[model samples]
Target: MLGNLFRAETSTLQDPSDELWDALCGPQSAAGKVVTADTAMRVAAVYACVRILSETVAALPFNLYQKTAKNNREVASKHPLQMLLHDLPNEEMTSMDFRTQLMAALQLRGNAFSEVERDRAGRVHGVWPINPDKVWVGRSEKTKRLSFEIHDGDMRTLTPQRMWRVAGLSTNGIIGLSPISQAREGIGLSLALEEHGARLFSNGAKPGGVLQVEGKLSDPAYARLRKSWSDRHQGGANAHRVAILEEGTKWNQIGMSSEDAQFLESRKYQRSEIASMFGVPPHMIADLEKATFSNIEHQSIQFVVYSLLPWLKRIEQSIFRDLLSPVERREYYAKHSVEGLLRGDSKSRSEFYKNLFNSGAISINDMRRLENMNSIDGGDQHWLQLAMAPITQSREPSSSGSSND
Candidate 1:
């Protein structure tokens, strides 16, 4: 089934155009393509359809093969895969086929699929393989013959040394776009994916380290460690989470006298300094020092990350597991729904939030402050995404009278 779509889409493959060659250089190329203005319009429509389908399908239990999870009774039987299963239930139709069609739609729109991954922290991270968005940083390579500049949008290099960036895949290591490729800029690239953007899994992603990312792991050996950490941390599923919290609280009681006080009170501890502080993990310092609050962008990132640390891995699994029970799946749906409502507007203003009474991730007020901090960079189309992005919201309380629910 997928083969047909691939054949049909590339059926007209003439020699690759210079424009096409330049566009699909590396990791940013995954977004696909947009040949005509009409293709853009069609792809926009398809993009929406695909997103809805992706979410619905992402939530399905594998054996059921129904993305709606026995609940979306009136979804009108959407999704090509769902329909294929419903009508034919034959071996011919495969997910590869669905993917081919999706890729065609993306290519038609001039977008490429670059890799994306969620970290153990449930923070979204990704690199551009062929970005029409051009939000990714451009790497400059000066050759003796000519200076060919590569950005996230360009992936395939004429030269062997050019990097093979992957889009739509969860990559942790910075893609080797070029010797001049900026890792920090790639970190900014990672920041672009926003909240649940990363496709990684691990309990500990200390952002402060001088990251020497070589590649992204579609599946890693430590994936289970991330699961273990995430359940206890992200979903409150950890067997020892209670013990960790108790120990943490006990340590917090005496402030500077605490055993972990070393993480906080040193003369050099400052928010801007955390990223550069040699070996200290940013989260450790953020929790102990709480000094990142001074910088709005950093503060929100700190809070959002800190708030979700325990649950990161769990959220990572929850975000894409086809194994959730119907009830469990619905809960995920409802929570994201409310978050979506908040996020869709892209302009929620509040000093802090009082949520998370149940998750026990952090104190409600503290969580709110984190939310306020994270809201700095707007334009997340959904709420949980807003939860991940930097907020420009103030530390002052909200007057919008949003329901606590």
Candidate 2:
């Protein structure tokens, strides 16, 4: 059923032009603050957090399932929706790349959008992503329904049904509240700190100081002296170089004392704040000031639970609501397999599987499947703890005249 849609074909879509990119990049937020994707990525912590989230999500597997009344479990199937979602959203991109891009957009802009492609029969065949910056959501005056308008040289309006939008928290539900817009001060502070550090390191990695000369010089002489000093001593390469001062000349440190500067502390604090805004643990973004072995492991779990789960749920619900047909919706649903992320160390997993296997909660085959190991013969049988007999059986007399301890 999905063969035609999944066939190999090249996409004819062109890259967004500079003009379009610029239009989408800035000048829209109510706070009058503009944070471009490129600018946000300049911050190492922000980049790391975004990468951790998007890569984690993109690596996980997704499945489409149909529930049958006769069967107790959902049966996995190779439906067209699965092909479009798990294999190829469009001919030009693979599923992982598409999801990674989408996740990055969501993380940075607090919104993501994709256009649905349908054939003559109105059956969805493909999904094409649209830059979230270029798309704006509005409510129709007549219909009073949410609609998305895309600006790509020309303006085109799309009904809510035709677009898949994953948005962060919003008050109006029509448009998402941008994290960059809401936390503009935090982002600005982080960027300013980074720029300050770069400039400080660039100018010989020293604090600005005053050169006390014995006698005042003409403006031209002073300018020439200053130019020569910078030319010979400025930048990281000239760091720690000996300065040649003229007779009766001395250098006086004028800027804030390094002890009071607290540059590293301020940068670290900003990193924590930025990570907090995204619900990511500081250690996940390499801020290891308070990180320990135990806490790091816990933070890893916290990242998946608190940070990525909401994003995953949003995508799952969006696919279920927008991609599935009316008939398919009744039976089929989309889900991301988070088991890989939830798995613990090998020893812990082994103990967990052993408990479940002994208690008859899970079969040997199920344990093997979870570990990605081939099932052995007779592994389908369930095992119960022999020591824990039924209460009624324990009270009954033994057939072989066994004495109770």
Candidate 3:
């Protein structure tokens, strides 16, 4: 489905630059680890952070609005782009699913690529997500215009204008620099440690140890003894089972203890490091070692402001630049309504809506819409604070000390 979405209309083709193809197919991370989008996601911290960010971005409602000329108020309106964005981004996925996968690609690969399907009128009809793993971006040496090469089963060159590209933080503007690439060493090390620990637990919940036989046996006997012992006792199921030591047999523990090795601490630290690399709060990624009640709320807000804002902005700008036609660009704009995520608990939200309603900043209907409740009749009327007084009416006592004037 994704492959068909990214197919180019024109047969015109260009080969991906050798350097670009190599970097994409076998990118080396700062940690000297081979970090592909799929492998990076295998790291638990990486997966958690990506899920947190992508799901948050996807959960927010995206809408198109037109700016009214008189009051400059934003009114919800439909555009040709809405047919794709608000309903189905592609034939296979709904809007949320499309955004979630798109954002996930962006989070892991530092770029999300899509092809904008157009009708005969040259208006956007659908948006198809392209797998970042299968896509490469390069600039033409002569024209300097960016081109996308999508390698599904076959390679095809995409017209840059027909592609929707959102790039993350980058030293070079053409392609996004991946966070996974930069932090791969730390994340890779953590993953290695985790696998090693799991293996340790699996193979009898103990680190390497030595088994000594009191009497030296013939080569075959020694081999048989070793294999027998392992088959009987080497595994978690055999852990803590009483071992009957025969004459001249002993067991000696070796290797550092998990504590001495700082194994658990290393895992925790690496989790935090991975979260930091992705601009996610460690607590959000389930690293709550230092999280407190007061700080968690602040952290949640910071996730929205610091972590997700830039990504959301990237998507928004891409939508405006690539999806909107010239006329639509003049009056219509796309924005994600993040109010739902930013809203506090019921009490806080109630107070917030109450204040807004009382101050006439938002009408009853507006509040209802935000709460996902049906708008009541006449709820559009705005209300202001009830108390007021004329400026000329002096409330202070005059110099004569009269109670009333």
Candidate 4:
């Protein structure tokens, strides 16, 4: 038990030039000892965000910072494809999709535009058939400034995540992150206004990270901008869980065999319809489909085994200084194996998981593992360590004792 408190070698996440996609997706290899289950999960979530960004950006605009319907109000977003998003599962929109969309939206805020492309010589340029608004083909002056300010906001919030989604970017794959850790990823999003760099208080410096800044726009416009950015970038623990997917309900919104249709149908452990309360994309819901589930029955056992499970081991290793680690969390022939990772014949996910639970009670290690798995990425990581820091022993009691001493 005491052995669980390990420290991984603190590795800096390097920015691979032209390899932002590679970095966002993940590094080709990793070495440091994984520190703790909590840190492990955060690291994994961070990777997930990175992968979301890498993949989404490479994939394009579909999922970045989509709008969602609040309350009983019917959903509609700024994107022309708003109607399509409103019909998606709420989980898809608010969580995974929401995360990706936030990154994409940040990218857009920093540099969104609708226009034809031209070369330096000012020769004729080809017109893109796609709608200019949906495509993040380039950045605008205002948008760039906003993007920088948004990154500023991230540092100010002191939260590690900076993600986005934009409805106009792509037809699928909604989320993205920068230097991702699960609870949130630190997004180094491309902003529109680079001219006024690092102007926190300097004159003529414009704020990029803010939805609204002092002296930028009128109160009404600023109010709308603030609300819009909030809807676009909201995540973390404070984020509301829009809805949970239920078993036996199929999300057949995109029709059979289409890419959208194939995504949700792949979650074989259970079936459910999730309306994207947020006006994001169908694929966004599918991105982190399994992570949000509270119940074991409908949990993304397969995804946990493949993508997320490794994180736990990494955490355990780094935390405990790399002792007694599993080669991988899921078995090759196990029941919940998905098409991508597993080696052979598959069984029902529940049946596969049931065999592991045959032992009636949970292990001490399992509880520890779960505790770390469920930990958030922000200050909680330091709460215990900070509380236990050593202090100087007092040579004299320097208290007035309420002035009655």
Best by lDDT: 3
Q: How well does model 4 score by local distance difference test?
A: 0.28
Worst 10 residues of 3 by lDDT: 5-14
Range of the 10 consecutive residues with the lowest summed lDDT in candidate 2: 1-10
**Each candidate's TM vs. the true structure?**
0.18, 0.85, 0.86, 0.17
Tell me the TM-score of model 1. Answer: 0.18
Residue runs of model 2 more than 4 Å from their true location after superposition: 1-34, 214-216, 390-405
- Poorest 10 consecutive residues of model 4 by lDDT? 186-195
Q: Rate the local accuracy (lDDT) of all candidates.
A: 0.30, 0.77, 0.78, 0.28
- Which lDDT tens digits does candidate 4 get at residues 279-382? 22223335454444344323333433543334323222221221111432221111111222232224553353344334434333433343345533342221
Cα displacement (Å) at residue 290, model 2: 1.9
Number of backbone clashes in candidate 4:
67
Error of 1 at 303 (Å): 25
Scored against the true structure, residue 232 in model 3 reaches a CA lDDT of: 76
Select the stronger candidate by TM-score from 1 and 4: 1
Model 2, span 129-156: residue lDDT tens: 8998677565555666666767777878
For all candidates, the clash counts are 76, 0, 2, 67
